[model samples]
Target: MVELRRDPVVERWITIPRERAASIEGLFPGKQEVSRGACPFCPTAMHEREIYSIKDDQGRWSVLVVPDLRPILEMEGTLERRAKGIYDGMSGVGAHEIVIETREHNQSWATMAADQLGLVLRAYRDRSSQLRGDKRFRAIFMAKNYGGMASRFSHPHSHVLALPIVPRTLVEEVQGSEDYFQYKERCVWCDVKEQELAKSERTVALTDRFLVHTPYASRYPFELNVMPFRHVADFASSTDEEIADLGGCLRTTFEIVKNRLHDPSYSMIIHSVPLRNASEHSYHWHIEIRPQLTSLAGFEWGTGFFTNPIPPEVAAQHLRG
Candidate 1:
C-alpha cells in the first residue's frame, strides 16, 4: 500500500510508499558485485512482466517495457482522498514502469545507435499517451538515472512514473511560464531558445528540428536542456519524423557529454504539460539533463538557489570540443 501525503506548509505532495525502504534495500545486494551474469535486465534473466515491447526486423525484442518489481505506487487502488485535521492525503494510485533500453547488458543510451534510441523514445510516447486516458493521473514523468552516484542499477534503463498530482517543481515551472506569457504575450521557452541560438556560445548541439544547449542560468555544471526548435507543449504529440530527429540530437549531445566528462553520472527528466491541461500554449516541453558532478550543501538546501561552479559558457565550450 502507498499514500500521497501533503506538506502542510509548502503544499507539496510526497509519495509515502510502505514498501519503498524494503524495495530500495533489495535493489542493491552488495557493493562488491561486479559481474553482469546476475543482472536481471539481461535477455536471459526473468522479468516480472512486459507491459510494452518493440521488436527488430528479426523478431527479437530490441526494446522492452516492464512493470517495476517493487513499484512505489500501485495501479490497482482508488485515490481515496481524505483529510486528517489540517493535513490532506490520498492513496498512491499510479503506474510505475521501466524501459529496458537494450537486450545487451553493456550497451547504453550514449553509445546506442540513433535508430535504437528513436525506438526507445517511441516507447515513451506510446506509454505516456496510453496512460493519459486515465483521469486519475495528472502527470506522467519520464526520467533516466544514468551512471555515477545517481544510479542504483548498472543496467541502462529509464523509469516512467504516472503521478496522481503534478510535482512541485513542475507546478512552479508552469506558473512561471504562464506568468511570463501574461506579461509578454509569448512563450518563455521559445524566447530562451531564440536567444540561445542567436548567441551560440551556450549551444552544444543542434539538428534541423531540435536544439541542445546549456541554459543561461544552469543549476549544475553541465546541465543541458534539449528542446524542439518549434514551439511544442506536449512531448507525446511529436510526429514520427520529429521523434527520429530528436533521437539524433539527443544521442549526439549524450556522446559529447560522455566524451568530455569521462561518462559521468547524470539524470535526464522529461518536462511537459499535464494531462488535464493538454492545450497549454504558454508552456513548452523539454528534457533537462543534470550531471551528478556536484553535491548540494546547506546553503542550497536552506535556500532554493543553486550554486554552479562551472559556467554555462565553459560547459558548452567543453561539449562543443
Candidate 2:
C-alpha cells in the first residue's frame, strides 16, 4: 500500500508509492498519436474503465474521467495514521483520476472552443464534489501540465488528486489569507482584484464574472491568474453561469498568451479552499497559469525567491496588445 510520510521540519506530507515506479516506464513510451500510434487516451485505444463522462447531444463524449492506470495514491485503502519513533505517517488512501479534455487527440486547451473548455471545467467540478463525500480525503488538487517538459503524457488531460492531508503550500496560503482577514477584515484577493481593475495596468482581460491579470508579485514571467469578480472560496460551488464566464475568460487569456509567446508551454493549477474547512469568506479560489520559459537554476532551488527577468506590468501590456 502507498504511504504518506511527513517531513517533520517542513510539516509537509509526501506520498511514497513504490508501486508506481514499475508502471512509469510503460506510461509514456513514445510520441502519442491519435490515429497511428498506441496512445491510451485516444478514443480507439482508451480502456473500458471510465469513472464518469460528459456527452454531447449526439451521444459522444466531450469530457471524460477515468482512474489513472498507475496512480500515485490508491483509491481503496484505509487512511490509518500511525507513528514510528516520533515520525508520523498515514496510508496513502486517496483518489487519482484523469480528466480527458477531448476525444480528439490533437485538441488542446489553447485550441479548444470555450464551450468545450466549460464542459471540461464542469467535469472537474463534478469529480471534485463527488470525491469530497469521502470523509478520508482532506484536499483535492486539480492541475494540468501542457508541454513535453512538464507533462508525462502528450494527451490533452488534467489530473485530479484527492489527498488525505492538505499540502503545505495550500496550508500556508489559507493561513496567510486568514491572517490578512483578521487584520484587514477583507478578502485579500478581492482587494487585489479591485486594485488591478482600478489601475488597469496589469490586467489582461475581464469578463462579467471573472478577471484575468498578471499578479503584481508574480514569481515567473507572464504568470497569469484568473480570479472571480465575486469572491468564492470553493471552485466546486461555482454556478453554471460563473463557470461559463470563466471559460470565456480563460479562452481569451490563453489565446493572447499563445499568439504572443508562440505556443509556450505552461502549467495551470486550481487553488481552492480545503474540503475540511468551513465556508471561508477570506479565501478566494483562483487559477494560476505559469509558463515554463526559463530553467530553474541552483540559486532558485536554494532560495525560495524567484528572479524574474520580465516584470508583470510589461507582460500584461504585451498580452493586452
Candidate 3:
C-alpha cells in the first residue's frame, strides 16, 4: 500500500511506498570503500590557508577551517552581474571553505566525543559569522556529506559556502514560513516543534536545548530534523552552552542512525536565515540529516516528489535507541 503525506509547514507531499517496506534493506546501496593515496586533510599534508581553528592543550589544532581545495567560487573578485540576450549571469565571486572536524583521520560524528563535536560547531559559527561581514554575500550555507556518492573523500569534514545569491529552495522555505506567520502570526517551525514535542510519536530524542525528531512528511527513510528550542534565526548566535548540548544531541542522533542503518551515507544541511536577513523572526534555523538509503529515479526528479519506503513513525521507533 502507498500513502501520501503532506508537510504542513512547506506543503510538500511525500509518498510512503509501504509495499516496498519489507525490502527496505535492498534499497540501500552499500557505500563502496575507495582506496586513496594521501589524504590532504591530514596534518602532514595540510597547507597554511587556515581561516579558523580551535587548539588543544598541546597547541595542536583540534578543529580546523581552511579554504576548499576545489572551491566553486573565488573570493578574489568584485560582484559583477552580466546579462546576455535573454539570460542573466554573475561572476563566481564567493567564499568556500572546509571545516575539518577533527585531527583523527577516521573519526566520525557517531564516535567522536561530544566536546570535540562542540568545537566543530564553534568553528562553523566562527567562520560563518566572519563571512557575514561581506555585504556581497546573500547566503552562508553549511553542509556535510558523509560516505556514499554524496562525498568524495572519507574524512569527516563539512563545507561552508558564502553564496552571492540565496538558493531557491531556501528562499522558498523562508517565504513559506513568512506566509504562515502572516496568516497565523506564529513561526511555522515553532508550531511544528511544539506539536512534535507534545505528541512524542515521531520524536526520537530530545535534549534540554534541542529536539531531534523525524518530520511528519519525511522526504527519505531515516531522515531526521534537529531543531533548537530557542527561536533564534542565526546559527552563529548559538551560545557555548547551547553548542555543548547540541553536540550531544547530534552525536546521539547520528550514532543511532549509524548503528541501526548499518552506517549508510548521509547528507546534513544547516538552513539558517540569509546573511542579510539574520534578524528574521519568522524563519527558525534547523539542521536536516537525510541518510541516502535509496536513489532518486525519474519519478522523483520529474514530479518533485519523494517516496519513502518506511513511515516516519516506524523509523523514529527504530531510531529511538
- TM for candidate 1 is 0.94
Instruction: Output the lDDT of residue 1, model 1.
Output: 85
Report the error of model 1 at residue 228, Å: 0.6
Residues 1-321 of candidate 2 have per-residue lDDT tens digits of 688899988879998874544445445747442234577787877567889999989998888899998788999978899899889999889999999898888867778899988998999899989998999988888899887768767778999999989999889899999999999999999999889889989999999998899999998999999998888898998999998888888888888888988888899999999987963888999999998988887888899789999999999999998
Which pairs of residues collide in candidate 3?
none
Give the Cα lDDT of each candidate.
0.88, 0.87, 0.84
TM-score of each: 0.94, 0.93, 0.88
The residue-by-residue lDDT of candidate 3 on 271-294, one tens digit each, is 989977733879999999989888
Return the top candidate by TM-score. 1
Q: Rank order by lDDT, top first?
A: 1, 2, 3
Clashes of each: 0, 0, 0
Candidate 3, lDDT over the whole model: 0.84
- Candidate 3's TM-score reads 0.88
The reply for model 3, stretches above 4 Å from the true place, is 1-35
RMSD values, in order shown: 2.4, 2.9, 9.3
